[model samples]
Target: MKISLQINASPYQHQAADSAWHFIQAAILSGHDICRVFFYHDGVFNALRDSRPPGDERDVVKRWSELHAKHGVDLVVCVSSAQRRGLLEQTVAKKLGGYQSALADGFRIAGLGLLMEALIDADRHITFGD
Candidate 1:
């Protein structure tokens, strides 16, 4: 099955991101394909490159990056949402004279059209959080 995920909550503050990650891992292990992961609202925080969780805790951002690296999953953060939350992409940050290294590896900033396309193309479109 080709599955796509939409996350709307921030990591640590809610269980949605953690649940989504575990689901993605299980699905991939079961021979399923993760087409994309669309991060919206506070979910965009998951892609922050400088996120530094404590050594005792799981690094959600790093886990997402590793997942993308290993499985070739498309991790996309909503552009408008990201901007609203101060999570700028490299080009946008550079143009705006903001921090140019905002997003983590394997994650890209895109519009809602990408989410819509993923929904249309995937066998299942699962949403976490609000």
Candidate 2:
């Protein structure tokens, strides 16, 4: 099945991000296709490249990057939401004189159009948080 996911909560602060990650892993193992993961609201924190957790703790951002690297899953951060939270894409950040590397690897910043496309294209659209 082709599945699309939306996450609205922040990593660590809430369980939604972690649950979405695990769900994606399980779905992939079951031979399912992940169409895209749309990060909205605080969920955009999952795409921060500079996120550094303790060595013992799992790095959620890195896990997301690796998911895109290994499985070719699309990790998309909502442009408006990210901007509200101070996360900007490379080009936009440069133009706005903001942090250039705000976004992590394998994740892209886009408008809601991509999210709508994923929802319309996927067989199932699962949302993990409010």
Candidate 3:
């Protein structure tokens, strides 16, 4: 099965991103495919590379990066949300006149069109709460 997980909250203030991470990992382990993970609203913060959790805690952003590195799953952030938070992809960073965010390589700053596309193709479309 293919899944698209849409996140809507800042990762630190809520467990939505964390829960999505576990679900993604489990699906990968079980031979299911996660089509992509889309970050919207404050959820775009999940792709911020500078997030540092306490030594004893989990870093949700890092985990999302790991998923991108290991599984080739697309990590996407809504372009509007990203811009509001000062996040950008390579091309977008240049367009915005800022340094390319780490999200440049690990994730893509996309429009809602991509989200609609994901929904059309995915077996299940799940939205994680804000």
- In terms of TM-score, the best-performing candidate is 1
What digit string (tens of lDDT, one per residue) describes model 2 on residues 35-125?
9999999999999988999999999999999999999999999999999988978888888895576999999999999999998999999
Clashes of each: 0, 0, 0
TM-scores of the candidates are 0.97, 0.97, 0.89
Ranking by TM-score: 1, 2, 3
As for model 2, its CA RMSD to the true structure in angstroms is 0.9
**Which residue pairs collide, candidate 2?**
none
lDDT of 3: 0.84
Task: Give the best candidate by lDDT.
Answer: 1
Which scores better on lDDT, 1 or 3? 1
How far off is residue 68 in model 2, in Å?
0.3
List, residue by residue over 27-123, the lDDT tens digit for candidate 3: 8999988998889999998888767779898877777777888899999899998888887767777876857564734777889999999999999
Question: What TM-score number comes out for model 1?
Answer: 0.97
Higher-ranked by lDDT: 2 or 3: 2
lDDT for every model?
A: 0.94, 0.93, 0.84
